[model samples]
Target chain A: MRAYLLARLGWAVPIVIAILIINFLIIHLVPGDPIQALVGDFPTPPGYAEQIRKEYGLDQPLLTQLWLYLVNLAGGNLGFSFANRQPVLPLILDRARFTLLLMLPALTCAAVLGVVLALAAAPRAGSLYDSSVTAISLIGFSVPIFWLGQILIIAFAIKLRWLPAQGMISLRETLTGWAAVADVLWHLVLPGFSVTIYYIAVVARVARASVLDALSQDFVLTAKAKGLSGRYVLWRHVLPNALIPVATVIGYNFGYSLTGAILVETVFAWPGIGNLFIASIGNRDYPVLQGIFLLTAVAVVLANVVTDMLYAVLDPRVRGSYGKNA
Target chain B: MAVQPGNILEIDALSVTYRVRGKTVRAMNAASLTVRDGEAVGLVGESGSGKSTLARVSLGLIPRKIARIESGRILIAGRDATRFSETEWESLRGDPVAMVFQDPLTYLNPVMRVGPQIAESVRRHTPELPLDQRVEELLELVKLPSVVTRAYPHELSGGMRQRALLAVALGCRPRLLIADEPTTALDVTTQAEILALLKDLRRRLGMAMLLISHDLGIVASACERIYVMYAGHTIEWGGAGAVFQTPAHPYTVGLLRAAHAVRNAEGRFATIAGDPPNLAELPPGCPFVPRCSHALAECSRDMPERFDARSGDPHSVRCWLYEKPGLGFDRAGTG
Candidate 1:
């Protein structure tokens, strides 16, 4: 197990670096100049743009700039955002917390709701409840996340007025401690739910299929014959067997939601990295974009590694295979 | 004669039907059998002969949605259990009755350690006992090493896995144990060992057993009495030696011939002609009539009820040939 963990962490290094390189190349490839975006659209003094460009080391050759970027990354310096003129690390870090606040609850709720509904539906697979669960999941899966977010805002925020339509909190409130947390959570409802729907559908669909499969396995018959209650059999024999695939979906979606938050954040105007990411693209702030992309890549890699570890934990066969390979 | 102390189980005219696609197909048609206290009974049949269905239904283990018991009585120790609720059945299971299924690898939870799988039943039935010690005792009872308790199903060999499954069944100390094709999934050599172990456990533990098998040889070695089923009906039943030596029903004869043909490799391998009738569209007569070589005109017109095939003996058969004394088809060892 120790060796497996070490091997996974070792593989994560090159993958994150590769993603960083791609992010750098892609940011540079876009057909716009950061200097022009940073300055006004009107013509600048001839040497003025050159002075600002040299100040940020942008006047260096492409390869030299790439080399300097890698060197700075190695030294843990993310440089400055072109638009904010602030350290990119602190700027992205400040927004990351808000994004996490939105995502963690959404992911947790999605996983719990998915597995619970799947367990309820699997035993009565042909019943109306099963069909309804399948149909709702299908609808949730097909609807676009941004569109769903808008629809939720319209219904809950505008029409019924049950929730705040946008933002992470009621900015006017001078709340603190518990009140502050409650206010933030209250404002988080629409966006968090919007983010949750798609993942809930994905996880439920996968979990339901696996649960049905687990129900039909021979061990399930053995469990039933043991006089265990249907609930006990489901919880002990069926759920554990079904969860490996559900965990895969949950982990993959959890990682993807880091970047996936863009639509939800934009729709709700939540002050997260997703909002920063969008604004950075318009301002052609390469450093901020690259930092967010690099962070997302590292997070995705970490989620996948954690998912692999979870697989070993859930299945003894997988754990044994990993031990042998290690 | 005084009534025997109530057979461990008495399945009377048990009929089960499965809803397939849109049609209800009868899986077990008035099948019946009994397992006396401490007696090992064999239920022999071809595929789709409802052997497994009988075993599963006896334990109330069949899923209610896929299959339903159309009519019958399942008497457990003289009490009618046909109307027993799920909760009542649950209590009865793993205490009065427990089952060992066909394939251990599939029947044993792959992710669960051997120790816990066995202990699940043990804990429920004997919560007063120390769980660890009981688990160790079960593993030892099945002739497995104590270290095997830590391993998962896939880690064990086929023979060892089946033993672990047996241990799971034995953990409950059930009075009546049902083993449905228990050795069907094992290799030939392993098959003998598992069967021997099952017989040894039955003898030592004094549990009544209902052994279901498609192979006549496996059942004969481990069981004292045999019940023969063809397509859903229990066509013949008697002492194992009587049924094997002077099998009355043509289907039973065919099964014995098939078993003997395999052993006698020098002779041409004999196989029963024609497939078993489909339960969905069975003819209004004996199901075996279409395949029986000695089928009479009357056999195609009506299904015969059980009749005495041997005088002063318990042997019985569901065949028209046994209705009269001078039927030439009653000759033994024709196969």
Candidate 2:
């Protein structure tokens, strides 16, 4: 167990460093300067621009700038955002919470719904129910996240009036505590549900195929002949064996979710790090960009390590294979 | 008379028809048989002879929601088991006719230890008994070493696992046991040990058996009476000694020839030509007609009923040759 923790920590450190370097390079290599982006795009005098450049240390060479950025990062600072004047880490953290409130519930919902439907429609795998689920999944997987977000906004929020339209919450009360929590959940419904549709389609199809294959194994037959009920065979013998594949998909999807893949976040106007990251690219905000990228990189690596650990817990065979012999 | 003759299992004219690609496929064609107290009967067949299907039906392990008995009866302990409810079957299966599968490790749950598995079945059927005593008795009965109960299934050797299964089988003190290719997964040495253990259990407990296997030699060694199935039909039935000494039907002859050849290097093993008939596309006459070298011209024209050729012993054959000769009947690989 100690070894597992060490290994995970080992893989995560380099990932953060790599992301930091990449983020630093990308923002620096951009055509425009952060000093100019902070002031304005107007045709100002070269002398005025040069002083602002000097103040921000942008006039220094690339290596000197990179070294100072690292030193500043080491001194307990993430730097103020060029766009908002807020500390980068705090801004990113607040946005991450909002995105988490939206996407996590949707991800979890997708996993549950997908697994249930897949198992129910598995035995007659190519039958009407299976095909219908597959077709629905195909649509869910293919439809653009932004388009889906718009459709939900138009149909449910505008036409049906079943839900509120744009923005994070209603403009009525002081948005904090209970009201804040409820408001986030309510606004999150459309974006979260829409994003979840893709996961559902992918997860359910994977679940059904795994279950069908697991049920065909010799162990299933043995379970049945031992006088266990059909339902028991399905729940015990089939599901545990079937879950290995579904778990893999869900784990990888969890890592991908941390990247804050931009489409859903933008559609919802989510103040997530991905949105900040994208804008930073345009304005060449090197410090904020590197901070967000490093954090995200660390998150993805940690997620994979957690997934591997979860696998060993769920199936002893995996742990056994990892140890005994190989 | 004779303490009510503890005939533990009875399977009468049980037929199973499966639907595949919108067509009804007759997997079992009115197959009838029985197992009385302490009698080891072999349901011998080549592949696709409906041997596995028959075993499944007997155990009520068919996979579907609305399964039809199709026709016939299965009586266990004087109760009609043909339409036994799931709950009723669950109650009766482990206690009355515990089944031993071909592979023991697959039969035992991998995550569970050897002792707990045996304990589970024991607790299910014999709930009144104390745990340790019940386990120890079972271990002693199967001739497994005492420490086996604590070990995981993977820890034990193949022979040990088979013995462990037997201990579980014996946990119920089942009147009849179904050994479906019991020794098929083991080496020859381990095979001998398992067979010896089974024979000893039967002798001591008077446990009747319904053994299904492709190995004629194993069946001949273990069973008292033998029933030969070919293409869903029981083509021949008699004592094991009689069947082996004088196999009347062509398929039985092929099986005996195959088993006998394995013993000696004098000649190539005799083989039946063609694959077993597809259950979905069974021809009108015998299921073996396409593969049987002894098939008649009329064999494909109509279904062949039983031909009880040998008198006074119920030794039967399903073929056209017994009725009349020279309708282009040719018995190859035989006299």
Candidate 3:
């Protein structure tokens, strides 16, 4: 297992480097002038753009700029945001915590609810409950995240007056300790649920199909024949086997959720990395954009590696195959 | 083998139908058979002949929504199993009766260690016993090494996996073990080994067994009584020796001939002329009438009832030739 992890890390290094290079090239290639976006609606003094370009090292050739960027990146400096005039790494790190706080619970909820709903629907597939779940999941999957977010805010925050709608917490009132935590949670619900709904649908459908497949397998029949109750058989035999594909789907969906968080955070005005990303894009803050992209790439790669390792742990066949390779 | 009072399993006119796309397909038509205590009964048939269906029904493992019991009764250990609820079936399974499926790989949970899989059965039936000890004992009973308990299903050879499955089947110390094509997926050598292990287990444990298979040779070697099925009907049944020596039904005769042809490495093996009947569109009379060479005109018009093939023996055949005395003599001469 250690050897497998080490080998995976060895492969990850080159892939991360490749991703960094591509991300830098794509940002540079895009039609945008960070200096001009920064100086928007201002009468530029003669040579002002040139002075700003020279100040940020954007005056250098493309290759020279990429090389310097790599050198600065390797030296643990994410450079300065052209718009915010702050170090990009610290800015991302501060906002990233909020994104994690929101996303982790949302993803976990989606996964658990999806599997539970799927399990309930699988045995009675084609029945009213199954069809209803299928229909609901389809709607959840098709509905846009921003639209869903607005609808949730209207329903819960405006009309019902049950929960707070915008931002991370109540700006009007002072809160501390558990009250502060509760306030944050109250605000999280709408955006968190909105972002999670689509994933819940993806996971639920996968869980349903996988569980149904597992139910049809001969081992489930054997488990049933062993005098185990249907519930026991489902819990022990069906769920574990069915969870493999579901876990893989969740891992891949992590990257998707990051992108989705941007749209949802914009709608809800949640102070997370997603909201920062949108602000950076509008400002043409290349450093911050580059930082967010790199972090997201690293997160996606780490998720995939963890998922592969988890597969090995969950399935002995996968473990054995790895052992043979080792 | 006489009709005994203390039969471990009894299916009385049990008919099962599968609902496929709004059409009811009769999978088993009033099939009835028994396995007395400590007796080994082999049910032999071609594919789709309802052999496996019979096995599944005996254990009440058939899917409820898809397959329905049209009419009849299933009595396990003289307890009417026809109306057994899910909880009742759960209690009955792995204790009074247990099953070993055809494909060993499929029967064993791939992700689970062999020990835990067997231990699960032990825990279900005998929760008082220490799990590790019971698992070790069951593994020993199947002649598998102690270390084998820690291995996954995929780690073991086909024979070892089958033995592990047997250990699981015996975990509850069931009164009857239903082996549905237990050796079908094994190689020639492993098949013999599994059969030998099953025979030994049956002897030592004194557990009645219902061994379902398509191989005549396998059934002949392992079982005392043999039931021959064709298309969804129990066409002929008797002591294994008697059934092999004098197959009364043409389908049974064809099976035996095919078995012999394979044994002798003949250039061309004998085969039943047509496909098994489609249950959805079954003819009014006999299911085997289309393929039976000795089928008479009335055979296609009326279903044949089970009749004694010998005066004093318990052997029986479901054929028009066997039912009419004069016709039986003439058919016997032709053979």
Best by DockQ: 3
lDDT of 1 at A240: 94
Ranking by TM-score: 3, 1, 2
Worst 10 residues of 2 chain A by lDDT: A317-326
Give the TM-score of each candidate: 0.94, 0.84, 0.96
Q: Candidate 2, residues A1-326: lDDT per residue as tens digits?
A: 45555666788778777777777877666677677677787888769978877877878998898888878877867877777777887887887776676667877998999988888888667788878988888788788878988899899998999877766778777788987888877887777788888889889978988988887776666555556666776776688778878888888787768555577777667667667777777777776777777677766777788887877666655556544432
How much lDDT does candidate 1 score? Answer: 0.88
Off by over 4 Å in 3: A324-326, B1-4, B262-267, B326-335
Q: State the lDDT at A297 in candidate 1.
A: 94
lDDT of 1 by residue, B33-130 (tens): 98999999999998999998899888888778888888988888777788788888887888788999998899999899988999898888898999
List CA RMSD, all candidates. Answer: 2.5, 4.6, 2.3
Of the two candidates 1 and 2, the one with more favorable TM-score, higher being better, is 1
Query: lDDT values of the candidates?
Result: 0.88, 0.76, 0.87
Clashing pairs in 1: none
Say what the RMSD of model 1 is: 2.5
TM-score of chain A of each: 0.96, 0.90, 0.96
Model 3, range B91-210, lDDT digits (tens) per residue? Answer: 789889999999999889998999999998988888999889989999999999999988999989999999999999899889999999999999999999899989998999999999
